[model samples]
Target: MPATFSTLAEFRTLLTHAPKIDAIALGEAQDRNGQLTKPPGALGRLEDLAIWYAGWRGTARPSIDAPQVIIFAGNHGVTAQGVSAFPAEVTEQMVMNFQHGGAAINQLSKAAGASLDVHALSLDVPTQDFTQTSAMDEAGVVDALVAGWNAVAPHTDLLVVGEMGIGNTTSAAAIAHALFGGQAEDWVGRGTGVDDAGLANKARVVREAVALHAGGDGLDTLMRLGGRELAAMAGAIAKARSLRIPVILDGFICTAAAACLAQTQPDALDHTVAGHASAEAAHRALLAQLDKQPLLALNMRLGEGSGGALAINILKSAVACHSGMATFAEAGVSDA
Candidate 1:
C-alpha cells in the first residue's frame, strides 16, 4: 500500500473515509461460533474476540499467524524539563537494545511468534519542547507518520505499535489532557519511576504545554504536544485500519496516540483492541474514555510493546478456538 500523505489535511480526509469492518464476515463468524461444538458462550470474550478479528480480516474463520510488532523510538526535548527519570539519550540506547534483541519487548515478541521491527525516528533530533512551541511542524509530523505507515509490512494479520521516548509520558499526558478536557494533574503520572516531586513537575509541564498548545484538531494537537514516536504509532494504527489489519494497542502512551485518532474520527479505532492496561495511573482513565477494556492487566508499566506482545498469545488462543474448533455437525455431535 502507498504510505505517503503529503499533508495532515490530506491524512485527515483519509481518516474520515477509512473503511469499515466487514459486516457480512462478522455475521458469518457469529453463525460459525453458534455451531461450534461447545456450550454456548463458554469461551466468553474469546468468542467475541474471534468474531471481531474475523470482521477485520474479512474472513469467517481468521488465524493470527502473522503478527507484527513495531517499536518506534524518538528523543523528547521535554526531557530538558526533568519530566522523566531517564535522560533523552536512553531512547537511542534502548533502540540499540531492541536492535540487539536484549529488550523485554524482544523476548515477548519472540515468545509470541511475532516479527519485531524497531524504528528510531531521528533519535538525534528530539522534538521541540511543547511548553514553548509545537513539538513538530507539519512537514516533520508527516515524515514521522509516513515512516510509521511504511513500517508495517504487507500481509500482516495483526499489528502492535510500541514506543521508546524519554519524557514521552509527559507528552502523552499533555495530549490526553488537551483532547479530553481534564486537569493536568488528572492526566499526568509517574513515568519511568519518577518520584513525587518529579511527578508534580510533570503535571506542571503538562499544564503549561496544554495551556500553550491546546484546542486544535487531533492532528494539530499531535503535532503540537505529541512526540515523533507517538505520532508514528498513530500513523501505524491508521495504516492498520486502512489495510484491514487488526491492532492490539499497548499502554498509556500508545493509547494516548490512538486517542488522537479517536478524537479525529470517533470510529477510527474500531479495528483495535486494548492489548493491556499499563500501571500508569491515567491509562485506565484514558481507556475508559476510549471504552476499550484491556485484555490483560498485569500491573505492567514497561513500554517498548512488552504488554502488547505478551497479550498476543491471548489473541492467538482466541483465534485458534474460533477457527480450529470442530462444528457440532462436522463432529457428528448432538447440537441439542
Candidate 2:
C-alpha cells in the first residue's frame, strides 16, 4: 500500500482499516516459545515480545530487519518565553549535526544497524507563541502532517519516529494538558534540564496556552498547541498503523506524538511499542493513559531516538530466540 495522504481527514480514515495483529499467529508464537530448548518463561519479556511481534507481522517467527529512524526537526516560537533551558537555535544546530552524522542519534542509528533520516522543516514562520494564540492554523497543521505521512508510506520496514525541536517538550506538555485535562505543573517537566525558575515558567506558559483554547478538541487542539514536527510524527505513526508496520516510540517528545494520534484515533496505539520510560514527569501518566508498557527504564531523556535505537537490539533478540533457537524436540532434549 502506498503511503499517500493529501488531507488529515484522509489519514484519519486510513486508521479505520488499520490491520490488526494476527491472533492465531500470536498464540502459535507463544506455543513455540514454550517448546523451545529452555525452561518455561526463562527469557522473561523477550519471550513475550516474540508473541507480540508475531501478531503484528502475522508470522509465528517474526524478523527485525532494516529498521529506520525518521527524525523531524522544527522550531517553536514559545522558546522566547524562557520555557526551555536551551535556546531555540539549538533545534536547527542539532538538525545540522544530524545531517553531518555527528549527533547522538546518528551514532545510535549506526550501532543499531538502522538508517537515519532527518527533515528540517519550516521552523520560524506561522509558529505563533502559543501563549498568545494557536501554533498553526488548520491548513498548516495538515500540510505538516501530509509531509510526514508521505515520508513513511513508501518504506516497508520497522519504524521509529523521533523529534528534534528545541522547546518541543513544552509543546508536548501543552498538548497533553489540553487533551488529558491536567494541571500544568503536573504535565510540564524540565525539558533539557531547566532550572527552578525555568520549570515554573514553563508550567505557567503551558497553563496559559491550555486555558487559551480549552474548548478545542481533536486536531483542533493539536493545531492550536502542537509543533510542526509533532504534527508530522502523528501522521507518520498513523500511517505506520494503517500499514501494520510496528513502531517503536522514543522518549517524551515522541510519545507526545503518539498521544496526539491517540487523542483522535485510539486504535493507532495498537501498532506501537513504547521504547522506554523517559525522565519527563508527564510521560508516565501519558503511557498509563495509553495502556502502554515500555521495554526499557534507563531514565534516559535524550530526544533523538536514542532509546528507540537501543531497543532495536532487544527486538532483534526476540526474533533471534524465536527463529534461531531449535525446539527441544529437534535438540533431542527429554520432556520435563
Candidate 3:
C-alpha cells in the first residue's frame, strides 16, 4: 500500500492511530487452543505465539503463507570516526550480494519460504557524521521513513525488517544510551568483529554522540543519532503495526530501531516479537527493555535479518500445529 503520511509529525499521528489486534480472533484462538487434543501448556510458548499471531491476522486459525523479509541498507557517515571494523563501501557491496542471493539472509529466507526485498538508501550520500550535527535533518529522515513505510507489501502476512549499514551498531548504542539514560559502555558492543581498541573507540563515539544530541524524544533522537537504515527500520515497523502484520524483529540494531517506536508509544510494538537474541552483548538488555522474549537464541549476530528469517520456520510450526491439529472430539480423544 502507498504511504498515507509523509512528515514525522504525520508519522507520529499515524502511529497514534495504528490498528489494534483482533480481540474476537484472540478469544476464539484461545478457545481453540484449549481443545487442541493436547494437555494444557503442552506447546509452551508456541501456543502463546499462535494465539498472538492469530489476533494480528484477524483469524482464529491463521497460517503464515506470505512472509516477507525486508533488508534496508544505508551508508553511515560515522564510519569516519573509526567506529566500524568494515568500511562503508561494504554496504553497497552487501546489497549487491543480497540481490544476487549470495548472502546468508538470502539462503535463510529461501529456507523459510520468505520473499526478500532490499532497499539501499542513498549509498553515495551518507548521513552526516552526527558527532558534528544531527545525522539527518527532518527531510532526510522523513524520506528514509517513507521508504521503509512504502516497502511493505500490503498482502504480506508476516514481516521482518533488517539492516545492512556499517557503523550502525554505534548508532544503535548511541540511541539506546540516549533513550535509556545509561553509560555509553552499557550499551556499546563489538560489531563486525572490531578489536578491543576499536571497541573502546566505538564506545567513546557513542558517548560523545549521545552527549551532543541529548534530550530529544524518540523521533528527535532517531533523527539526531540514527542513520537512514535505522530510521527506515523504525518506519517499516510502524507500517507493519498499521497494516496489522505481525513482525519478527531481528537483532540489536533492529531492536534499537524498534526501541524508538516503544519510546514513542508504549504499545507500538504489540505486533512485534523478538526473532532472536543475537550474540551482540547488549541485545539481551535491549530486548528486556522492549519486554520482548526472543523466539530463538543461537549466538548468531550476522545481520541482514538472518536471525529473523530463521525464525519464520519456528512461527510456521507453531501456526501449523495450532491451526492444523484436530480438537479432542474431532480426534475422538478423551480429555479426561
Candidate 4:
C-alpha cells in the first residue's frame, strides 16, 4: 500500500489535542523508583527523564527499542555568498565520511548501539563513487521523508534527526528570521569558525537572503535557500509525529529545519526532545523561542547527530532504570 502524508494543519491540531501525561502511571513510576532501595532523587534528571519517557509512551516498561538516527545531508545556496568558513564541498565530503563510519556521529552511534541512516537529499557538488541520491523538491521532500519514515516506522521506538550541510547554518538562521520574525542579527551566528568580520558578513548574507525570500510561502523559502536534506528532515518529523513516534532533534541547523516544521505544524514539538545546547548563539535563541530544554550542554559545535547520539545514552540509562530496577515488593523490603 502507498503511504499517506499528513497536512501541517492537521498535524498541528492533533499534537495540540493529544492527551496529557498519565499522572497515575507517572506517580506509580516515581513511587517505584523511590522504593528501589536507592536514595531518593539520587539519579538526578535521569529519574525525571525516565518518568517522562514512561508518561510519553504511557508504559512503565517503556523501552527505546530499535533506536535509529537519520542524518540528512545537502548543500545550501547561501554558500555562494562565502558566509561559511568551510568550502561547500565539505558537505559532500562529510556525507561520505558518515557513510564510511568516520564521522563523530558514526562513533557515537556505535557506542550507543543505535542504527544510522544517511541521506544525501542534495549535493551541490556530487562526489564520484559516493552512494547518494539527488536533491529533492518540495513534493519530493515530502515523498522521500515519508518513505523513510514508513520504512522504519514499524520497528523503531525512538528517532533522532541530524543534518550535514556546509552553509546550512546560514540557511537555517535565515529561515528562523523569516518565519519567526527575528532580526538577521538575532538569528545569525559564526558557522564553522568564521572570524568577527566573517560573522558580520554571514549575518549580512542571511539578511539579504531573507529579504529575497520574503512574503512567500514556507516551502518556497525552503526551495530557495534551504537544502533538500533539511526539507526532507522536516517532512520526516511530521511523519514521525503522525505515527506517534518520539523524535530527538540535533543542533542549530536541525532545529532550524524543525522550526520550519513547527511553523507549518505547531504540534510537531510535542513529540520532540531537544538533544543538546549548541555553542552557536543562534541555537540558544532558537531553543528559547521554542521553549525547549536540551538534554546536554557540552559546547558541541559539530553536527552529524553526535550530540544527539550522546544524549541517547542518557535516555537508554533512563529506560533501563525504569524497566529493570526492582521495587521494594520485588526485593522483599518493607517500605517505610
Off by over 4 Å in 4: 6-35, 124-137, 140-153, 215-225
How much lDDT does each candidate structure score?
0.93, 0.83, 0.93, 0.72
Q: State which candidate, 2 or 4, has the greater lDDT.
A: 2
The digit string of per-residue lDDT tens for model 3 on 103-135 reads: 999999999999999999999999999889999
Q: What lDDT tens digits, residue by residue, belong to model 1 across residues 1-336? A: 878579999999889999999999999999999999999999999999999999999999989889999999988888889998888888889899999989999899999999999999998999998899999999999998888888998889999999999999999999999999879999998999999999899989999999898577888999999999999999999999999999999999999999999999999999999999899999999999999999999999998988898989999999999999999999999998
**Pairs with steric clashes in candidate 3:** none
TM-score list, all predictions: 0.99, 0.94, 0.99, 0.84
Write down the TM-score for model 1.
Answer: 0.99
Q: Which ten residues in a row have the lowest lDDT in candidate 2?
A: 1-10
Task: Judge candidate 3 at residue 102 and give its lDDT.
Answer: 95
Clashing pairs in 1: none
For model 4 the local lDDT of residue 105 reads: 93
- What's the lDDT for candidate 3? 0.93
- The TM-score between candidate 3 and the true structure equals 0.99
Model 3 clash count equals 0
Question: What residue runs in model 2 are displaced by over 4 Å at the alpha carbon?
Answer: 1-3, 124-126, 153-155
Which of the two, 1 or 4, has more lDDT? 1
